[model samples]
Target chain A: MAILDPTTAPRRSQLNQRHVSSHALFKELGSNLVVSHYGDNDSIIEEHSQAQTLAICDLSTLPRIGFKGAGAPSWVEAQKLNLPAMANTTVLQGSGSLVAKLSDQEILVLSDIFAQSKDVFHLSEQAKIYHKNYDKQVYSLPRDDSHCWLAVSGTLASEMFSKICGVDLRTHKFSHSHIAQTSVAKTNAVVIRNDLGSTPVFYVLSDISGVEFLWDCLLDAMQEYGGYAVGVSALQRLTKEH
Target chain B: MKLLTCPLNGKRNISEFTYGGEYHAMPDHLTSSPRDWAEHVFFHDNVAGIVTEWWCHTASSFWFLAERNTITDEVIRTFKADEIYQQRVEFTAVASETQS
Candidate 1:
């Protein structure tokens, strides 16, 4: 008997074939595949274009995990995890990952660059240690499949968000590493202010099932701002620039 | 839209929190009768004056204690439940050590 390879299984993002343009280029990321670029391989045009307008990119493939229960804070502390002490705040860890303290008892861990790397697996294993030690007091909630993530960036990003969100997300008000759980386009979403590149960026996480609907709604809102979709290649380039 | 101050999340829209009703002491389950347990679980004083209650922020799932005036629907203060519980435990430990 042989173990099954999860990567070989058919896996697609919520946007999948529906959002891919005629000239889009696709690539595999872990078990799932997503659009690497809308058309250009270098993403130079996309990067330059986004400098003035807004760009929305799907990040559903990123690794995300949730820690909850009364003992979560202590458990995280015992693991020597560097997280913000206050709730609803996100801190960028030494590894370039994010540890968001949603509440005293709940936290969300996200990694953009090392989702498929051994570092992420190490973090997961460390979490398991606490889970085993505090069996009844802590619970782990894997969110890779439960939420659809989008990275919206550029100068006009805030303007585009204003159309869908009620909160004041201007840089002065929201600031860096601030997290808000509010309605976006009439759907509940968690908006985290973590800029990508030199431009302002927000990572929006919403229910996985409602991703397509939310994406369509966001695209419609982006149209007026002359916003367009960028693929993971462009997103990677932006991250590298910063 | 009304806002509620979550001790953890700061001031958030009231819609983000779920009212958990008035807080009351729970009778010791090992000693208390079934009627007492049921009363504690099913009944609330519904007081008009200042009262303490539990509230949960839906997004972060953070639960905290809120002191409010039912008559005015005004929140007086909010605090974390864990901090209060930890204080009580420490107090009990200190008292026990002194007695011993």
Candidate 2:
């Protein structure tokens, strides 16, 4: 069945379109990547760059915001630390705990139920006020299209990615905390760190119009991994499959 | 990329950091020196020479007590957080040491 394709229509007031729920968003993206929405801006597709993995998502169809400065961590921690305020040079630990709650000035603890909590708006406001004394700014933007996530692992995955997507993965030049909006085949994806260390997280975000095209590109890239495209059911049933 | 050169580490990206604010923004509530407090709180010389500043190395997870030249943005000496200040001693001891 065809998903909601918005690229072709390009409506003027598109930010008002429906949102992809956290359950469906995570369920659809599979297990390779942990998924969650931040604030009312759901368009953000941020994930830990662990190993040689790729996390694809339909976040373009959501909303997003950017917060920068020294107080960024403190402000973010004011509510929850699920997203630890690591140095711009660092990345989150792989599989340790993807979810976090911001408890104090310098602490972010892993929280179990913080993900589904609906009080993000209230918390964000308080954090923003606290941020005023320090140099911090947050930018919230809603996306106009749906996003898709793909997490690819293994040694050759980087080489495969370089072939599928024209990006320079030469370790010294590009490392973690670096992001670029580039092309993967004919589609657009923001390729980031696939490894929490120096590896890269190949985040491919495209409009629904390019879904089929991206899917084909991914299959070709993963052909050597015995990688077959799987749905949420198959992803959830991986433990059983193994 | 606003670059700040650490006297110890040479030049590096500014992203691996946490701004420590003006040279001395110590809270007024802690110390009561109507004159000393005024100078520390409101009066900043903005000198060009080496200055002591607090810099949290977010990447290294360490706080740096750096001697930075504010005008050139050159960090002269960088030390660990603990090394920035001496171990806590009684006020009398500090006064005696200064006198001696």
Candidate 3:
């Protein structure tokens, strides 16, 4: 098989430069390119273990979309998406997509790691096809171009987040599928708790323009806990365990 | 860092908030004089005691009303703007022309 170059992929992460400098092996997920792992082929298992301890993975290239405004809730429901009962909560759909209710009138949809879920893609396509048919008050927010998504996982993830974020993200305080919209390292971001299997994972989304700064800040905060970056494969492996 | 509770987003570091200004009831644009418009838009009471003010959660962009003691720097309470603004107020061109 020919090795795929991330630079030539249809979509790439904003931290592509950082991954390239770290000797990252790239793989294609859907049409997007993401880091498969770092180091030699034999190190993938080691990376998976490292992920259980502490690791950050870039999922910025994944499919994610948002809708907001007065009619957003009913409009999303009409599309067969189940929303969380309250604001700042999330619901994992049977279709493998996750819907996060940011507020009564806003919801963000994210695709599963394997890229098997077509909910995000479908929502976007539906909007494009039925722009006039949908509720006028329900507007689409294409987060792929506006926000950069990163996943911080493992046992020490919360401890690392405390260094920069104001929210109390300790497992007990912030459970799975809970959302926090606050400042992290002085940059505004949305932190959502979405565990992968038994591993505690928090997805952080921030302005794409300031992603490099936020990435550096997160890395610096995690350094004291001996945390480092892993690749998507490590995360994919974690989900298979327990 | 000081903490402030947002009506919608809960408590957060003060740095995450932007002080919009004192919350003032809008003047009747069609009948109010130019001086009223100037005072409403460009000036502030800067009250020394407890007063209602506007604050926005920078992260969520959620704006709410806060009653605080300016002297003690203590926030008395926070509430959603909807509590006071029950209906949408639109200014028509006629109102704009009257103000002009």
Q: Which candidate is the best by TM-score?
A: 3
Quote each prediction's TM-score. Answer: 0.83, 0.35, 0.92
TM-scores for chain A over all candidates: 0.86, 0.44, 0.97
Q: Give candidate 1's fnat, 2 decimals.
A: 0.35
- Tell me the tens digit of each residue's lDDT in model 3 across A118-208: 8998899888876767646788999999999999999999998888887999999999999999988988899999898899999999999
The candidates' DockQ values read 0.33, 0.03, 0.71
Pull out the clashing pairs in model 1.
none
Best by lDDT: 3
B11-41 per-residue lDDT for model 2 (tens digits): 4456645766446635444456678878776
Give the per-residue lDDT digits (tens) of candidate 1, residues A1-242. Answer: 13223244376576765645435566666555656666555665655567336888887866778778767778766766687978778988776778888776787888764345433456578877665666566788778778888888787888888888877898889988999887789788899988766668888988999998988898899898888777666666666665
**Which candidate, 2 or 3, would have the higher DockQ against the true structure?**
3
Candidate with more favorable, higher DockQ: 1 or 2: 1
Candidate 3 lDDT at B94 equals 72
Error of 3 at A85 (Å): 1.1
User: What are the lDDT figures for the candidates, one per model?
Assistant: 0.75, 0.41, 0.89
| Residue A136 displacement (Å), model 3 | 5.0
lDDT of each residue in A1-242, candidate 2, tens digit only: 22323333333112213222222322212112222332222322222221224323233322222343335454554554346343222234333322221111222211111123223333446656764664323322212233443444333456667676544644455564444344567465544443423333343444556665676677676676544332222222222221
